[model samples]
Structure formats: structure tokens, C-alpha cells
Target: MALARRTLTPFGLWVFGAAASAPMVVLAGGIVATYATTRVTALPLTFLLVAGTVAVLAVGYTAMARQLGHPAAYYGILANGLGRGWGVAAGMVALVAYNAIQTSLFGLFGATMAAQLGGAWWVWAGIALAVVGVMGVRAIVLSTRVLAAVLTVSLLIVAAFVLACVGRPAAGGLSWEGFDASGLAVSGIGGAVAFCVAAFMGVDAPGSFVEEAIDRTSVGRATIGGVVVLGGVYALAAWAMGVAVGPGSVAEAAADPAAGLPFAVLERLGGWWVPLAELVLIFAVVTSMLAFHSVVARYVFAMAREGVLPAGLAQTGSAMRVSAPRGGSLTQTGTATVVVGAFALAGADPIGVMFTWLSTLGAMGLLCLLLAASVAAMTAPARVRGPQAGAWEWRLAPALGVLGGSVVLALMVGNVGSLLGAAPGPMYPFFLPAILTATAIVGGVWAGHLRQAKPEVYPGIGRGIPKTHAVPDAINVSI
Candidate 1:
């Protein structure tokens, strides 16, 4: 069954995209880790630079969405643009990447929740898994509202961090050293940029909601708007951190493991803020997981409907008058349980195993998809691209996106060990790319089999539905 279309307004789309980015978690963990790992003080500038690149990527991404009008994101785009074989390959990569991201957060959420409240980490993970599965089958409006409330508090907490840091100037007197473009030209900048880029991993999530948005334009607005809003908040908070410790010492201060930079600064406020921040950090991670659950489930639904995977996964459950993709949600929940359980059985570190390894894998895979998407936006058949497409949307923006994506992809590759924290080894660094490559190969082989045995279905891998079943473009616009 298709997701309930026109059920989400532009604000709902924004909330979904922002919740996926998880602003508070980025501030508390991503910023601290970036500074420590890269020793780069110009994170504020790096974030803005990366955001501009992503914003450029979005220009053609949304234009492609308007032309295709399909629920499946990369899968649909590649299928229409590159042909069914490439589309199915992308579908496989997307499924694995998104599911990895969705389940990996269980490690962080479980660990954080256990630290604050008493319980086994896996036990907490199981509980949240069940909760998300249940919520996933309900009317999406319910999930949107739940996420909106959680995201609101998370952003407020981020704002508080920025405010507290700005209130107290260090010896440098409100230093803007973190914003220095020259600071970014130094060594280790690639690792810093890669880390900052990971913080915005879910920004493209809005494209998946295109079929469900109240306005088709909201897809681009939400996608680009999410990047800008997230980048601004991250830049402001990172800069404020430099202000609190003096920009020159920001990287040095972050290096002191015991100090816990941002929290250390917030503690000086000397009230309930730190405790509140901790509690909300747990919620922020859960919200991020939930947001990813939505993305993964939709990918499952999109592919399943086309006979690429099991068709049963396309089934939807009607709860309170809205058709929710319960089939897809259940599949992801079950898969996550097995993956998380295996890690637990091996006595793995939640942060080291599930969180670090899986999140890094997912981040690299998503970056690959983003790059492929820009190329597809330009290469898709002109007939499928629609006659209204312009030079900027059809060509220039996507070309720029390709250049930017190539640079980011290169940085991430060069710094893969840093991102995964892999020890020196023959194959450890190549692990992520290897997994994605094998998965894509499997998908290609499956497509070849389908071409031989199920010729009809093979031809329509990425196309959403027959034209007869589609909502007209004029009607979609009016809605």
C-alpha cells in the first residue's frame, strides 16, 4: 500500500527532517568528537561550507522528485534515470544503509538510557525497538507530532548551550577564530569536514516524504531548509563553544578527555541544566532512531511493491483511518533485533560496535547515494524529467552537486579509519566499502535473475506505478 499522501504539511516535513538530524545529539557528541579527532577549530566554517554543498545538491534532487513523483528516493531516481538494473542496485544499497543507521542508534539510546536509569543496555534497546515498531504502524500524524515535540525540546537545549557559552567570554573576548576560513586550510580538515558532514546525515530524508507532502514544493523546501537550519544551529553552537574556551584553545580544550567541553561550560551555569540536558539527550537519540525508522520502512515498502524483495513487505495496516506500512516496519524491527542481539551476545561495546561501526558504515553508504543522485538528476531521460525542467535544475546545480559530492566522498575515503576508528589492518579500513560493494553486486545479480525469469517485473524496478495509477501532476500541485 502507498503511504497516505497529502497528509503531511510543509511544517510536518521540516519536523521530520530536523528530528532525523537530532540537533541536541549533534551538539553534545558530534561537535566534541570532531574537535577531538580532527583538532580543527574552524568547525563552524566547515559546517557552513558543507551545508552550501548539500544545498546545491538539493536543487536538482527536488527537481528530480517533481519529475518522478515517486515514493522511493534513490531507487526511483536511479531507476528512471539510469535504467532498472542500476535502480535495483541502488535500492539494495539504500535498504542496507538506512537499516544500519536506524538500528545502530539503539546502541546509543540503550547505553544513554541505562546510564541515567538502571537497566541492561540490550534490555533498553529491545524496549525501544518494540516501542518504535508499535508507533511505526499507527497514523503517521501521531509519529510526526511525537517527533515535533521531542525535536522542539532538543533545539531549545541547543539554543541554551549556545546562549550559556556566549554569555561568558574567555580571555579572547568572544573569539570568532572558529570562523576563520584560513583555519580550515590546515591539516586534518578532511576528518573535521567528514565528521561535520556526518552530523547532517539525515538532511536528505525530506525527499522520501515527497509523495506524502501537502505541497510538492515542500520537498525541496524541507530538504534545503533542513540543511540550512541544521547548519546554522551547528555553526552557532560550535562557535559559541570556541567563545567559552577562547578559539585558539578550543581544539586544545576539547583534547582534555576529562573536561567534557560543552557540558563543562554548561555546568558553570550551576543549575538543573546539565541534568536536564542528559535526560533530553536520551530522548534526542531515540527521536533520531525513530526518524530513521520511518526512512528505512519507506524504503522497504517502496522496493517490496515492485517485486524486487518480498511483495508482502508492501502491505499497509490501516490504523485510525491512515494506511501505515506495518509490513515494512515489522521487517526492519525484526532485522534490528537480530543484529543488536548478535552484538549483545558477543559482549560488544554499544558505542564501539553498534554505534561506531554501523553508523560509519551507514554514513559512507548514504554519501555514495547522494553523489549518485546528483549524477542521476542530470542523466535521467528528458521525457521522464518533464518538459518544465530548466537549465539550472536539469544541469548546472546537479553538476555542482557532483563536484561537491566528489570532494566530500574523497575526504571520507581518505579518513575512513578515523571515522570508523579502525586499527591498522589489511582490510579493516576497506570494510565499509566492501560491504556496500558486495550488497550492490548481490542486487545486480538479483536484477539479472529477474530479467531472465521475471521479465515483466524486471523492466519496472524503479518506476513507482503504471501511469494509469499515478496522481496527475496538476492534481499533485493543487494538493
Candidate 2:
């Protein structure tokens, strides 16, 4: 079948490309910025680890681009390398993980907006949920442009606010002494790294845009450029927040991880501008939500087309408005609705629930994907590795990156109580184990049912994976 295509303008593509990085930046940088300055001190090791992990993503991403030729190249590589089951599993992880992060942020945004505006809690929650509905099912380009404009304006306002504080440095404040991490928790390092990496989630955005690249080289160039830009943005933004607010003030700045940094800085500037700052941050969060929804929608659409998922997910908008994965759009929309509606119905605090469930879980899933993708990059053939071949990116770098990331991933699961502050009760580590197992079991059962009920339609499971194979020691990445 001929693949569906969208009629997005060049500008729209650029917007999608840029906007895709916004949520990750805020999630990674803004949220962490809050913790770094206030809750923790300037631990060189912590900052270095945070910066190094992000920098490593750039290196690995560039290597993949050199080898793969385009973002879609991973689709083929993964399908060939991991077998169908694993590939589909990878997609499951990505879709659910990304949605978790996006959904979690919705709660955070609602709570912050409500507090800043002093409005009815339900009204703000309703508005945030409403935005999700509108943005969730729309064509990618339309959503991207709107998100780009919002991110640009919101970020500018934040930058100005941060810079002003630096220029007029508060009395007896702004000194290097506060950078010390002496009293910080060694145990918290893993948690910090976990969130630090969340900001770089959009590094994979360029892969999704492979089809739109002017050429193969453009795909490679764009991928490299995107990662570099993302790392720089996070590092600089975090450092700025540290300088202006001091490391001791992160908890005070935004007691909640989901709170916007600009709103806190605005309060410092003057009490009167609090509402304005809140509104600006709301725009940023909303834009971030829409941008991520579009990105994840494409992943679902792709998985469907490949037969890893129901074909309906692969369906494009009527008249080729977008080439979103078929059958996936509805799934994506449905998931978002349930996530948004569940919290609303339960009367739970959006930010608190978001912090506890969606964002943290999403971070876990994304980390898994990154480690898997790094292995894919390293194991790819030299012909495809291009210039980055034989370099650190293809050699010790990915190996170490995966090892480091996996360790952090394990810590996140192990320390879930610390991060989310929720006891597993009798389950201990069983909560994560149960959730992951259930998701995998459901996905596996669905795949099996598809095989039995509609053998003809089943896209064969990834290349090496047998229908009933065991999970291998080596990481797999395709679905």
C-alpha cells in the first residue's frame, strides 16, 4: 500500500522539530533546576553526570544518523535486529512512556496555573484537559506551529526574567559558595540523573522527521544538530537558574517538580507579575503537551502500519492531512483521555498525581528506549556507520552509556518510594514489576490474539524474535 503523506510546509516541519524538544527541556531542565538550586547544592559530580548523560545522547544520536541515513533507518534496523516481538515491545514502551510524561505534565500545569491565577481548581483542570482533547487528534503540522509559537514566546519571557535577576543580583546573594553539594544525598544521585535525562527525550524527534529531510545528509546533520542544541539549552538554562536563585532555594522556588521556574522568578521580581508569569508558563506547558502528543501519535501510526499494532492506528487523516500511524491515533487519543479524565474524576491533585505516576513512569520507559537505541547504534553495520564509525560513539561510548543508564534505571525502580513518596505497601519492588509485567503481558496477549484471529494481517514480529522466545541478554530495539 502507498504510504500516506502530510502537506506540511517547511516552516511547519521546523516548528515540529524545535517544539518537540521543548517539553523535554522543561521536564529535564526546568524541573531539575528547581531541585538543583533549592534541594541540593552544587555537587560537581552531580552536575557533571547530568551534563555528561545529555552530552552522551548527542554523541550516540549523531552516530545513529551517520549509520542509518535517516530517522526511519532505525525502523528497518530494529525490525531486522530485534525481531518483531521486541520491536512491538519497543513501540509499546515508547508510546506508553511518552504519554505518561505528557499526561503527568497536564496535572502539573493545571495545579500551577490554578495557584498562580487563584482560580477554581476544577476550572483550571478542565481547561488543561480540554487542551489535550483539541490537540491530541489534530494533524501534526497544525499542532507543531502552535506549539512553536507558544514555546518561543514563553521561553523568551522566562529568559528575560532570569537575566534581569542576574543583572541586578540580589543583595548578599549570588555567590559561588552555594554551588557546594556537601549535604546532598548520595542516594539521590540516581533520581537526579533520571530526571536530567528526561529533558533529552526529544533527541529522537529528528528520527521521526527523517522522511522530511531534504536528503540523507540532512537527516544526519539534523539529528546531530538537534542533540547538540538540546544539550546546550538544558545546560545553560539550568546554570542560569542556579545562578539567579541559588542552589539552596530550589525547594522554595517551586515546591513541586511540575511548577514553572519563570513563575517563581517572576514572584522574586515583584508580586504583581505573578499572574502574568503563571499565564506564560501555562502557555509553555500546554504547547509542550501538544507537541509531545503529535510526536507519540506518529510512533503509534508507524507501529500499526508495520502490523505490530492494529491497522486502524496506521490510518491517516482524510485526504492525507497527516501520515500518522493507522489505528494508533484512536489509541493515542483514548489513552490521553483516560489519563486526563481518570485524575479529574478521582479529584486527585494533577501535579501530585502527575509527579507520582505518569512522569516518573514515562521517564523510566524513555530511558529503556535510549539504552536499546544505543545498542542498535553500536551494533549497526560499518557501511551505515559512516564517519562516526570506529569512533567513541560506536565503541566504548554506547556500551558505557547503556551500562550507566541501566544502573540509573534500576535505581529509579528501586528508589521509587523516594522519588514518588508512595509506599509499595506489601509489594516492595513489586509495584514496578507488576505494572511492567502487566503491560507486557497485555501487549503479548494482544499480539498472540492477532496472530490467531487474523494471521494474514499480522506484520511478522521483529526479525530475530520467535513468537515464543525468551528475553535475550542483549538489548533489542525495533518496535
Candidate 3:
């Protein structure tokens, strides 16, 4: 079943992108984590710089997305621009990445709520997982409303914090040292940039909803606009954090108790805002999870509809006469439950282990996908990319995007130790790339198998549907 069309506006699309970034969570967890892990106090500058690079990526990304009407953005772009095999690789990576990122939030969600309420971390995560699962199978518009509402409150909290920090600057009045470029010259700045880039990870989400958006162009607007708006929010928040505790002391303050740093700052500077901020942050993470869950369900739906996976996964449920990807949503819910349970059984640190590891892994894979898509956009034929194929957006922007994306990817990978807190070792810090490589290899092999066993379905791997492809009897169920 297809997603409901004409249900999302430019504003709604922007909300999906922004909410997935989880503004409060980013300000609280991500920004402070960057300061502590990277020991870089110029995080405000890092966010601004990363935003510029991400905007470059959006140029080619949106252009490619405009050409394709598929629900799975990265998969369609890769499959159409490159080949069936490459598209399969992109699709597998995307599927794993989005799921990792979505489920990763549960760690933070559980921990935050467990502190607020009386329960084990996983218990709160399970409650949210159930709530998100229900919402995931509802109408797209319904979920968007939830995201928009929660994100609005989160943004307000963000604004409140920014105002309070700027109002009560430490020592010698207000200072601009956080924006100083000289601070970025440190060894671990790449780690700071990587985390900052993660803060904007969801901005590309509008592309995933292109087919559901009221206007395809709105996807472009929302994606690019999200990058700009989020950049400003993050920069301001990071700067405010530095201002609250003199810039030079920002690293020291953040490192003392990194995860609690934002709350401490808020409690000190804003007096009474800490309670509300923490409450909203937990909900903000939920909204973020909902946004990513919605995106993942669509990806599964798109792949299934094309007969790439079990065709039964393409089945739908209805809300307000609009179809929701029921089978896909349920599949994601089940997968998430299993992962969350395993972590809980092992007594993992919700924030340190689950959130830190999986989210970064997701971000890393996505950066690779972005780089590949940029190359695909630059190389695709004029006919395949449609009328505006030869424009600067299709040509120059993607070229620059590839360059910028590659540098960012290199920096991020080079500083993996700081990002993961892994000591000098071969097994720990190297797990992410190894997993991605293994996934790509598996995808390539799967594509080859499909080429021989299901030649009829091969041609339509990335185009959304197949005119002649037959569903495999073993996995295809009539629902």
C-alpha cells in the first residue's frame, strides 16, 4: 500500500526534519557531549560550519529527490542514479541506519524518564516503544501533529535557555569566545564536527516523505530550511552554554558530568526552567523516535511494495481513510523490542552504551549514503534526473557536496576514538566501519542472487514498483 498523499505541508515536512533532530535532546545531550568528548569549546562554530556542509549536501539531494517520486529517498536515488546493486547497498544501509538511530533514542528516553518516574530504564522505553508503535501505524498526518506539538514545546525550552544564558553571562559581561575559529584547530575537532553533524541528521528526512508531501518542492524547501534553522538554534544554544560558564571553562564544566551539564546550566541560569526542560526533553526524544520510526516504516513499505522483501510487508491499515504501512510498522516495532530487550538484559548503560554507540553508527552510515548520493546526482544522465538535470544544482552543487561530504566523513572516521571513548584498540573503535562493510557486502550478494533468481524484479529495484515482478511465494502472504 502507498502512503497517503497531500497530507503533509511544507511546515509539516520541516517539523519531521527538525523533530527528528530532537532540538532539546541535541542541545542537552549532543552539544554538551561534543564539548566533553572532543574537549572543544568552539562548538557553536562547529555547528554553524557543519550546517553549511549539510546544506551543500541538500542541494544535490533535493534535486535528485525531485526527480524521483519514491518514498525511500536514498534507496531511490542510489538505485536510479547508479545501478540495481548499488541501490540495494544503499537501501540496506539506509534500513539499518534509520532503525539504529530510531531505537537508539530509547536509551536516552528510558534513562530520562526512569529518573523522573519510578521504573527501570527499559520499562519506560517499552512504554514509549508501544506508544510509538501505535502511532507508527496511523495516518501520516496524525504522527506529524504529535511531532509538531512536542517539537514546538522543545523549541520554546530551547529559546528560554538561550535567553537565560545570554542574560547571565559569566565574568566580564557577555563574551564571543565560543565562536572563535582558533579553538577549532584542536586535534579532536573532527569529533565535535561529527556530533554537530549528527544534530542535523534528520533534516534529510523530508526527502523520505517527498511522495507524501503536498508539493514535491516543499520537500526541498523543508530540507534546506531545516538545515538553516537548526544551525541557528544549535549555534545559539552552544554559544549560550559557553556564555553561562566562561568559554574557556566550557570544556571543563561539560566534562565533569557531561550528560547532566545542560540541566545543571539550565537550573543555574534559568532558575526554575530545569524541571520543565527535563520533562520536555524526554518527550522531545519520543517525538524524535516517532519521526524516525515513521520514516523507517515507509522505507520498509517501499521496499516491500517493490517485492524486494516479503510482499506482505506492504499491507496497510487505515486512519481517516488514509493508508498506513501496518506490516512495515509492526516489523519495526518488533525489531526495536528485540534490540531494546537485549540491551536491557545485558544491563547496558542507556546513554553511554546504547545511545552513544548506535546513534553514531547510524550517523556514520548516513554520511556515507549522503556522499554516495552526491556522486550519483553528479553522474546520472540528464534524462534520468529529469528537466533540471543539467542545472547547477544537479552539477556544481553535487560536486561540491561530494567534496565537502567526503572531508566530513574522513574527519568523523579519523576521530572515532573520541566519539566512542574507545581506547587504542583494533576491536572496539573499528566495529562501525566493519559492520557497514559487512552490510554492503551482504547487500551486493543479495542483489546478485536477485539478478539470477528473480530477474523480473531486478529492473524495478529502485523505481518504487515493478510491472512484471512476481512476489516470492515463501514470504508473500495475502493479508
Candidate 4:
């Protein structure tokens, strides 16, 4: 079955992309943690720098969006520019990365619910899995609506907090300390930047649903819009957090961020909102997982249809020109269930083991994918000649994206132990890189075999279902 065409407007696409970023979680979790690690009054600066870098990346990304009609953006870009071999490698990395991200959230969701409500982590996880499974097998519109509602409520709470901080600063009063350049000159600057960039992890996810967007242009618009909006929200929230806690005490507060920095601030400014904010946070994580699950399901559907995986996995349920990848959704949900169950059965610390290991590993793999995609964006224009591609969009912007992604990758490598909340060790530092390298090698070998034995399938390695089998006009039009 084929995905429905023209089902998502620009707003829907933006909401979908932004939901994947999980603003509430990043604001309350990632930003606060960055202050603790770097001990630098430069949270806002780090966010701005990361935002600018991603915006540069989006220039090429959006440019390429017009040419590559495939839902698997990273894989298609690589295939069109680098080679089908690298495309296969990207596809492998994407499946692993997206699945890791989706599954990792189960730990956060379950643990948070258990702490806030009264239940076991596994029980909450199982319940979440069931809800997500139901949502995942429905039409895209249904999921987007849920994402939109969650995002709207969560962001409203965030906005309220930011306004409160601005209106009532702590002891030091309103200050721009976080944007000060000198404050960024710290020992863990690289790690801080890496963490900041990771906050925008899913900004490009909307490209995966271009085929379902109301207008092809909505894909690029949604991508750029997500980056800008998420970046602004992160930067503003971090700055407000600094204001809420006196600038002098911000670092100390961040040291135990997970202990409830945002809650503490809200309690001080608007005690009544604390309960509401907590509830919003829970829903935010749930929606984020649902959003990421949808992304993973699409990747599996796209890859399976292209013959990279079992054809049965590509099966979808279709009605009224809309299709839901029920098979792919079920496959991903099953994988999450198994992984979560294993962790619970092992009696492991859900937060320490499941969340940390998988999230950090997934972040590393995604950075590698982004790095490869940046390269593809820079080179693909030479061969495909996208609609309005120019030196700025195709060359300079992508060049910057490459540099930025490489720096973040290097930082993540050096600080992997810290990011994983583990003690420094050779084994911990090198494990993720080694796994990624092995996956790349395996994908290359498979692509080579397909090239020699199944030439027809090889050409469509990143393309979705073949045109003959796809619903009419279901594929995106080249801009």
C-alpha cells in the first residue's frame, strides 16, 4: 500500500518535526545539564551557535529536498550523490539510530511515570507501547494531530515559565551572562556544544514525510521552521533558566538538574503551575516517542519497499487514498518491547542503563548520519542540479554543515564517557564508533552484492515503492 498524498499542511509538518525535538524535555533536561557540565554561563551562546550551524545545514538540506522525492532523505541524498553503497550504509545507520532513539525513550517515559505516578517502570513502558502501537498503525493525520496537541500544551507551559523569569528575575536580576563570549572559554566547551547540537536532533525528520505533505515546499519549510523555532525555544528557555535561578547559582542548580531544576524555578515563580508542568512533561515525552516511532516506521517501510529488508515488512493498510505502514509499525513496536523487557528482566537501572546507553549511542549514530548527509548535500547538486541550487546553498552552506557536524562528532567521541554518565575508560569511549564502523562495512558488502546480483533493485535502493506499484501522485513532485 502507498502513503496518502497532500494530507499534511505546512503547519502539520512543522508540528510533526518540532514534536520530534521534544522541546519540554530539552529545555528542562538537556539545557540544565549543559550548564552543569561546562560550568560556563554560555548556555544561550551554545544554543545560538548550534542553531546557526543547523540552519546552514538546512540550506543544502532544503535545496536537496526539491530534487529527491524519496521519503528517506538521508539515504536518497547519499545514493544520488555518494553512491548506492553509501546509501545502503546510511539506511543501516538510520534504522539503528531511529530505533535506538525510540526505544531509549521508553526508559525515560517509564521511569518518569513511575516516579510521578505509582507504578513499575516496566508497567508504564508496556502501557506506552500499546498506546504508541495503536497510534502508529493509523493514518499519518491522526498521529500529527496528537503531536500538535502535545506540542502546543507543552510549549505554552514553557512560554509561561520564560515570561515569569523575565518579569521576575532572581537576586542578580535579568542578565545576558549566558551569551557572554568570555564565559564560553571553559574546559568542557566542546562537550557543551555537542550536547547543545544534540538538542536539535530531529529537526530534519519532516523530510521523511514529504510524500504526505500538502505541498512539496512544505517539506523544506517545515525543516527550516523546526530548526528556527526549536533553537529559539531552547535558547530563550536556557536564558530564562539562568534568570530564574540567580546567575551566580545557576551552575550549582544545574549540577543536579535531573533533581528538578525546572520544577524548582516554577515553584518559586508560579507554585500552582508545577503540577501542570509535570503532567505536560510526561505527555511531551510520550508524544516525542510517538513521533520518533513514526519516523522509524517510515524508514523501515521505505527500505523494505526498496528491497533492502524483508518485503513483508513493507506491507501497509490502505483506505481512502491513505495508507498506514501497519507491518513496519508492528515490527518496530515489537523490537522496542523486546529491548525494554530485556532491561527489566535483567533488573537493570532503567535510567542508568536503558536511557543513557541507548540515547547516547543513538545520538552518536545520528551525528554520523548528519555528517554523511552534509557531504551528500554538497556533492549531489553537481549531478542532480536541483531547482534553485546555487553556490551558497549547495557549496558554502553544506561546507559549514560538514565542519560543524565533524566538530560535534569529535566532541562526542572525546566525551562519550561523560555523556553516558560513566567513568572515563577506553572501552566506553571507543565502543560506539566501533559499532558504527562495523555497520557501515556490513551495509557496503550488502550493497555490493545487490549491485552484482540484483541490478534493478540496486538502483532503487533508497527510492520507496516503485512507481508502477505506488498510488497515483503519491510520490512528491520535484520542486
> Once model 4 is optimally superposed onto the true structure by TM-score, how far is the C-alpha of residue 131 displaced, in angstroms?
0.7
Decreasing lDDT order of the candidates: 3, 1, 4, 2
Stronger candidate by TM-score (1 vs 4): 1
- Return the TM-score for candidate 1, rounded to 2 decimals: 0.95
lDDT of 3 by residue, 1-479 (tens): 56666677889999999999989988888888788778887888989999999998888888888778677888889888888899888888988999999999999899888888878999999999999999998877778888888999999888888877777788758888778999889987888888887888888898888777668888788999999999999999999988988888888888886436777767755567888887788889999999999888888888888878889998878665676778889999999999999999999999889988899889998889888888888887777777645567788988888888889989988877777777656567778988888898888888899899999888879885333322221121110
lDDT of 2: 0.56
RMSD each, Å = 2.7, 7.4, 4.6, 2.7
Going through the candidates in order, what is the number of backbone clashes in each?
0, 23, 0, 0
lDDT of 4 by residue, 1-479 (tens): 56667677888878877998899989777887778777767878888888887777777766666567667777777877788899988888887888887898899989999988878999999999999998898878778888998999989988988987887788647898888888778787877877876788887788888767768777778888888888888989999989888777788888973647877767756678899888888888889888888888887887788888788988887633467777789999999999999999999888888987788778788778877777887778454755556788678888988898777678778888777766656575578778888888888899999899988889877654345544554442211
lDDT of 2 by residue, 302-398 (tens): 5555566666666654322433333444565578667777777888876656545676677666666667767776666655566545668676777
- Report the Cα lDDT for residue 3, model 1: 68
Cα lDDT tens digits for candidate 1, 1-479: 56676678888888888898899888888898888778888899999998898888878777777667666788888888777888888889988988888888999988888887978899999999988988888777788888898898888888888888888888746787888888988778988878877888888887787766778777888888999999999999999988898877777788787877777887867768888888888888888888888888888888888888889998888776666678888898899999999999999999877898888888888888878888888888878777777889878999999999789888987888777766546567777889999998898889899999998888778776433422222122111
Q: How many clashes show up in model 3?
A: 0
What TM-score do all the candidates reach, one by one? 0.95, 0.77, 0.94, 0.94
Candidate lDDT values, in order: 0.82, 0.56, 0.84, 0.80
Q: Best candidate, TM-score-wise? A: 1
lDDT of 1: 0.82
- Winner on lDDT between 1 and 4 is 1
In model 4, how many backbone clashes occur?
0
In terms of TM-score, how similar is model 4 to the real structure?
A: 0.94
